[model samples]
Target: MDVDFLLNKGKTIGLEGLEVYMVETELLNLTISSDKVREVSSSKTFSIGVRGYIDKRVAGVTINDENLRVDAAFEKLSSLIKTSVEDPNWAGFPPPRKGFINVICRDNRIIHTDYAETMKTIKDLMEIMKDEAIREGAERAIVAEGMTRLGVQKITTANSEGVHVQDECTVFSTFMVLKTVTGKGESDKSFWIMNRRFDLAELESLGRDTARLSLMFGGGRKIENGEYDLILMPQAAVGIIASTLIPAFSALNILEGRSPLRGKLESKVLAEEVGVSDNPELPLEIGSRRFDDEGMPTSSKVLIKDGVLKQVLHNYYTSSRMKLENVGNGFRRNPSSPTTPYPTNFFVHPGEVKLEDLQREVKKALIVYETIGQWMSNPFNGNVKATATHALLVENGEVKGPAKGVLVTGNIYEWLGNKLNGLGRETFTSEGIVAPGVWVEKVKVATE
Candidate 1:
């Protein structure tokens, strides 16, 4: 679609501050189950999202129908904007930025990847899982489920405020679940790897590690309910930490009185050892982007430094309303949705202690590997209650055995603030959050 034509058409129709965002995506997907290929599919999608100021009120519309005419879509959008309700806090779009940091967000190999290559990758991964399962003494190792997705997306934004930017990115993601039946019992574990670049070696390691964890899942025992030291794996830690902190960092949530950090800027809210930031320039990360949906330049923003609340994320609307700098966190699920501040490549800085060293310091603890129902927990109050699907009991700085059907419950704010014990030196990235294993001093754990 011609973005300039859309903008000019809106202007000619008496629209003010018109903007256009177009996204074109090509995607390929494969799924496998029980060591057999189940499905293979590919698709292409084009969507145009338009926003304009009508009578000083902000309104927007999205056009996704491939057969629909662009001119007719523009006319419909103009009519809707004319009757849209007025927003008292409506501000014009951002002015053109001078420079944007060049981010390595695309991988040529991924973009050019074909269906044959994708199938080969999945088969290789399945073979790796089988070998790992045999090494772990499982009677049989089956790929219970596996999925591979590859996509390339092109984003273009043009606005009457003299903002015009276009960028393209490639994404590769894979997930595998290995089920092993040993003489002791049967267990299953899953692993996920995603990035802008494809690395089969990393996926191999993920499979091996997941299989090893599953092999250690039998011979469980119930534990008494009491306060004990807890070590959260990177994936587990991200699930709990991100769910609790992401909401609090949103300027929109703060404005709505739904955030604990609403008025706590510059205050120490976390432990002195903790620091957090939103880094969109991280090399080859899936979340890296040069600009936001609103054509605002993206950059690394430190939201917390040495336990103090440093900054809250903002889009143009929140930044203008609150008289603050826009850190380029503006995001929209699609063109039809309103833009809001959201994290891009959010991370918690790793500490000096290694994972082995941190575990050695724990006298009595539970090393939680996976949890269920973490998203249902409340973030505003920092409350979390999750069931550990795979956990290990640590006694006297030694891993005793697996502890299943256990409940790990705690308050995120308290654990990260005062009860924080240590952090692992090695970091892991999953689901857009990069973090290391975290240890907390006191948490309640019991068998279900």
Candidate 2:
């Protein structure tokens, strides 16, 4: 048996009744390759985590071994049971738990040694992209894909008063990223990619198109900073929105004085039409899970409801601290779960206009794509001072070609929020999230 277990220890010091929760084990292993060479390889680990509540304070610790020093875990928790300064609503353990439903899993599937199929699929995908690149005038291109298999078994238990649970789940998936390079000499440029489901043929096409974008960058020049119609790719939109604004959905962040969305609960955040959610139900995604690590069922949870802030993601502690509902986002990668606020399977619902339509509406505007040195060049302010790998100068409803040595610098929120003119019909669901392309106004563009 590939068994990993956790030993738990605890002592209650208060009248509120002490409780201890333990997760027995979780397993994982995955292999990914490219160009017939394996790039990512690893094996599963059996691990354990223990959480203890004493005098309204919570502490947790984790270990991975056959002879788990459960008592030692408690010894360490001695220092961890410090009082939290912030006040939270108290809504304790879930009532009447029925482990995850429709949890997609299969036995013997975890041992997939399908190197042949992986190579063949990658070859086909690269070939398709190579041909597409030639058509778009690129001399060379490279493509890569990463596949993963996830299997985890979790068990949660409390010292009788309530809560004892366990569940198992597994998943398999793959993702591709393609890059195409073009031009000659000092004019050489590259276009990155377009998001799509894991398909090599489509991967090739995206690479080709991206390369085409770089090649087209010859005719672009600096345009003054001002308000103009705008069209944004899904990647660009997500880059800005996620980094600048989305972190506030955490009840932890709000309580900790770390989030900008603090004190704005039940208020409007995004545009009225904007609604955000996490759907573990997405067909295939890295974030898909049978149940939250705490053995809580993960169902659809609406974060921003028609622009109004609704519920926030929570774990057992946060739910216990703040008498609010849990959104089932309690996820801990290691068994000793240290509560961290994060997003899993995030998404921005798409609008109805297609990319082509948004482009036409630009009508003498700049199409910004591919930002580099986003963290460095922006000086940590997330004011993306980016050079568009495939930026185009559009005029009178036509693509007038590309720009080079150009820089776009500005606050993502101010530029995107007030200027958000429209959104695209299509979307990319990669890394377990989705953000359709967007259209905005008022940007600062310059030539280097």
lDDT of each prediction vs. the true structure? 0.84, 0.56
Candidate 1 structure quality by residue, lDDT tens digits, 1-448: 7888788888788887888888998889898888887999998988888888876676777887564476777677777777888988888888888659889989887877888998887898788888888897988888989888888989998899999999999888888888888887888888777778777777778877888887888666777778789888887887887777787888998998888888999999999999999999897787799999888899898999999999989998899899887758888888756788898899999987766676677888998888888888787877888888888888888888888798888888888889988888878887568988888888988788
| lDDT for predicted candidate 2 compared with the true structure | 0.56
Q: Judged by lDDT, which candidate is best?
A: 1
Q: What residue runs in model 1 are displaced by over 4 Å at the alpha carbon?
A: 219-221
- Candidate 2 contains a number of clashing pairs equal to 11
Cα lDDT for residue 268, candidate 2: 75
**Model 2 worst lDDT run, 10 consecutive residues:** 1-10
Taking the tens digit of each residue's C-alpha lDDT, what string does model 2 give over 173-273?
A: 44444444565412223323312123445445555554455455544555655445556677666555555545556677777776656776798756666
Q: CA RMSD for every model?
A: 1.9, 5.4
Assess candidate 1 and give its TM-score to the true structure. Answer: 0.95
